[model samples]
Target: MSKRKTDEVTGVETTGHSWDGIEELNNPLPRWWLWTLYLCIFWGILYTIAYPAWPMISGATQGVLGWSTRANVAAEITAHEAANAELVTQLVAADMPTLPQDADLNRYAIARGGAVFRANCSQCHGSGAAGAKGYPNLLDDDWLWGGDIDAIMTTVRHGIRNTLDDDARYSAMPAFGDMLEPAEIDAVVEHVVSLSSSDFDAALAEQGAVVFADNCASCHGEAGLGNREMGAPNLADAIWLYGGDRATLHTTVEQARFGVMPPWGPRLKEADIRAVSAYVHSLGGGE
Candidate 1:
């Protein structure tokens, strides 16, 4: 090897590296920093050996400690479930109407039901249960079926207009686009609008009254009050499922609406269904 070059000014050795006239100093790293770096490398090796680190084709290498975050989480879940086992049992068998009489059961149901609602019902009914355009609001007294706790329970268990469950609440509005003239449909739309609003054509509504009585009154009632037995919504209320606007009303009248809610009875546990029902009933809308 060639003798190392020394800088005359600083009396320090130069590394083999150079650029233009600048040369690199062959200076040693600080003793503390070097020792710290070596300690970090040793600690990293220990960590890899003691805890999970390397990924394999099928899974990560299970370290010597054999500890798992997943296993810990599962254990915690099992413990919580064990604690709530009695309350869940009570919730399943308890009379729905008399649920509020038992404060502990009612509280547990609401808390558990809220979690179920957020995970399942929130996609359609909204996180706050205020409802979307086609979905019914749980916070209001207006219900297409009924607002009582029993009614709410039945609706939750069976659902509305779904084919999956045999006991599902079923109803179908006729597509009047195929049954009636366009002018006749428009007239009926105006009449329906007149039920909840003052901004409607008198002439159209008058003609539509006769049409409504013949076609819609059986399900909607003579005054458009709606028949809950038939799952018909109250038209007099400003709250609309699809909408009460003229355009929306016209589409609803012409094409008709067939909204479907999947049965929860098959998917959720009996206790869960009851809990969700109780939770819905407590939202100020249930009678």
Candidate 2:
């Protein structure tokens, strides 16, 4: 047996292990610290027994309480729906045209409608209702269909140029490229250009006026003022769906524009439809 050694500085006994001349202290941990560690292990075991702890083949261990976060969330949703039942009923029964007449109901409708617009209409019309190139701007006075509350409701319900609804707004502009000779088409283009501004060859515009009277005037008025009944856009105004430039105008005259809007009546509830219509009408450009 080797001789036992003591530390010179603290006078503690050696652990009987050494590297070179250095020795490890035989002093144990503090009693309070050891007890604290034991208490933590005990608490952890208790917690495991009381709560969801061990994983099983199919699921996790369910404690005696039978608590589930998913079930709690489902119950909360059911409760919330029950709370709004009355408002939903009123919204469904309310007259759409006269909806704005009732101040309280109108405010509630607009609030709900804003949510509806964000979810559905925002994809095309944008969140702020500022539409893109093909889409009509909701914030503008120009409307292909009527902009009144009744008209807006109808358009939203049935949609535009879509097969989903029989009463959907439909109009077809003939591809003049197929119908008119290249030179005739050119003359017509000049006339269409002159409708909004004086930036055109006067001789070509005069020739196009004759072509306009024969073909276009049947739907569009002689002055190019749009006929809302036929879903025709006013060519005289500066507002353009695709563009207003000569090149864009040439393309429009050569090939017609056909845009489709799917009917929302089958997908959205009546209340949601009316609410969104009200929201749009409230955007300050409604006639």
Candidate 3:
């Protein structure tokens, strides 16, 4: 319990408490360390005064810089737009056919179009335009309307199954549920399925033959070869729009499912529509 002097030069004292005969020093904190601690406190106070630091029930204080995350993002976008002025100009002026000549411009438009498509079309068409059961795959060559660049552009410019747009692509498939009885629809379904393969229920197809002639033959043709002028799909080709499954067939018969593709022309810039059309047309089935 004896006190001791540790530093003779400064006469620093040691704590009277000891363990194993080793005492604890009672030296003051180093001047440099104390100054650094004070500096941190001052910096914090200054930072609070200069920036939005205080928290209230409503919101934090508006910093002197008057900065916001949204403002920062807008500024960045503005800067980017300014930097790409020339490219944007080119995109606006260039036609779809000539776009491939300017690789940089084409690439920029494609990137922009891809972002737009992801935001808008990805929900139904899928991320890669693979499409859902009812939706037609853009990547495939099975187009209900047409797969040419001009055709795609026309489709995109005028949405299908949409009555809202005056120029919307409109076509009506006979609702077997309303037009014919369940038994008759079943017969037609069996007949339609049979077209894909050699196996077919002859009895059901015989019954369906009358129904097909009366209701379907007008657009689908007597042989079910399809009428391109009416955009009626070739039933014999095995490219089912809704699906080839029995359930999908039943649903199609029960209720005529109309797949609608939104027109991008009114919503998106011309350049973007052209780029997306080109990209979609290049997906292997483009005529």
> Which lDDT tens digits does candidate 1 get at residues 1-287?
85469988888998867889788889999999999999999999999999888999999989999988999999997898799999999999999999999999999999999998999999999999999999988999998889998898899899999888898888788988898899998888888888989998999999888888988998999999998889887888888999889999889988899999989998999989999999999999999
lDDT of 3 by residue, 1-287 (tens): 45666755556687666889676778789999999999999999888877778998999987787767878899997898799888877876777666667888878877776776787778888999888777777887777778887778778888787865787777778677887888988888888777776787889888888878888889889988887667788888887767876678878877876777776668877766776776777556677
Query: Which scores greater on TM-score, model 1 or model 3?
Result: 1
Per-residue lDDT for 206 in model 1?
90
Q: Which 10 successive residues of model 3 have the least lDDT summed?
A: 1-10
How much is the lDDT of residue 130 in candidate 1? 98
Q: Over all chains combined, what TM-score does candidate 3 have?
A: 0.71
Candidate 2 Cα misplacement greater than 4 A, ranges: 1-81
Best by TM-score: 1
Of 1 and 3, the candidate ranking higher by lDDT = 1
Q: Considering only N, C-alpha and C atoms within 3 Å, which residue pairs clash in candidate 3?
A: none
lDDT by residue for model 2 (94-180), tens: 877788788888898898889989999999999999899998899999998889988998999999999889999899888888888
Ranking by TM-score: 1, 2, 3
Clashing residue pairs, candidate 2?
A: none
lDDT of 3: 0.78
lDDT of each: 0.90, 0.87, 0.78
